[model samples]
Target: MEENTFKKGLIDGLPIGIGYFSVAFAFGIFALRCGLKGWQAVAISATNLTSAGQIAAVPIIAVQGSLVELASTQLVINMRYFLMSVVLSQKLKPETTVLDKLIIAWCNTDEIFAVCTGKDYRLDKRYCFGILIPPYLGWTLGTLAGVLAGDVLPAIITDSLSIAIYGMLIAVFVPAGENDRNMLMCIAISVALSLCFFYLPYLRELPGGFTIIICAVAASVFMAVKAPVGGDG
Candidate 1:
């Protein structure tokens, strides 16, 4: 039964694996361009399956941002993972051990969370491992390929490929926004705020990391206050 569940998870995670490959490939190239070695790029993807956060981190690293800047940037950008993990904990099998939770937490990407939590039944450890492993492999392999190819590829091609990351972000948010007015509003507000920070002289002078934190926290607060979901205070 556990074997069958593991197989089912692999089959369900196929598309996510494919998507991860392309995104991680871009990350590989980007990381190299940002001055990381090929091995470092691969190591990053293997350890941290976060596409957006990793991409955002590259510039900070290139600028030699302080530890506080790095930590705060990651915290604000990846804060959603905290909520995702909490939701996933509820869907885990009651018998899941601390070790299992730790492993699952380490490998919990957004795609993994989506696949694991979308199931109606409590997730078994084997099933979670099956879903987690393939994408993890894909991401690492893709990053390796990208880092190797980054130097050989023409500047034009490598530069153009950078846009793929933004495309991935749009792919995630656009469909959900179409269905949820509140989410749509939140996205719009966030984008507007981000643009303001970019264009306004004073705000533009603020550290990029802090700007992101302010924009994200402000948008979340505005949404919570203006469009609180069914729950009470």
Candidate 2:
């Protein structure tokens, strides 16, 4: 039964796996450029499952950044996952064990979360595992290819390929945009916060993780207060 469930999850995740490959490939190339060993790229891809965190960490890795810096940076960037996990946890069945929760938490990338929880399917450990493993493998394999290939590919080709991951992000965000007014407002707030962070020297120096928390929490709270129960406006 678990095997069949895994097969179903694999079939569902096939398109997502293809998209993750391109994104993970870009990360591998960036990791290589940052002077990481090919295996290191694979390791990070396996563990991190986050593009922004990996990208942010590259500079830290290059500069031999302090542990504090690395921890703080990742904390700032990945703070959104806290909210995402909260949302996902609510959708899960009550019988989900602590071990299963551990796996789900580890595997809840932007893509995986969408695939697992966006549908009405009640998720269990087997279902989560089936959904988690393939994309993780695709990401790991893509990074491996990038590191091994080095800079052999033409700049134009690589640049074009890099956009595939961003395209996936848009696909994730766009659906939420159509159905969720709060999401649109959150996006607007994010953009505004980004602009402020870029131009304001004081804001620029603020920790990235805390900045995200502040912006997300403040915006969410404000919107929750302002918006009606039905989410009008």
Best by TM-score: 2
lDDT of 1 by residue, 52-111 (tens): 778888888878889787788788667778878888999888999999888889878877
Off by over 4 Å in 2: 1-5, 180-183, 199-201, 205-211, 228-233
Candidate 2, residues 171-222, lDDT tens digits: the string is: 8777876887877887678768877876798888876767767876877787
Evaluate residue 45 in candidate 2 and report its C-alpha lDDT on the 0 to 100 scale. Answer: 88
Please report how far candidate 2 places residue 98 from its true position, in Å: 1.5
Least accurate 10 contiguous residues by lDDT in model 1: 160-169
Model 2 local distance difference test score: 0.78
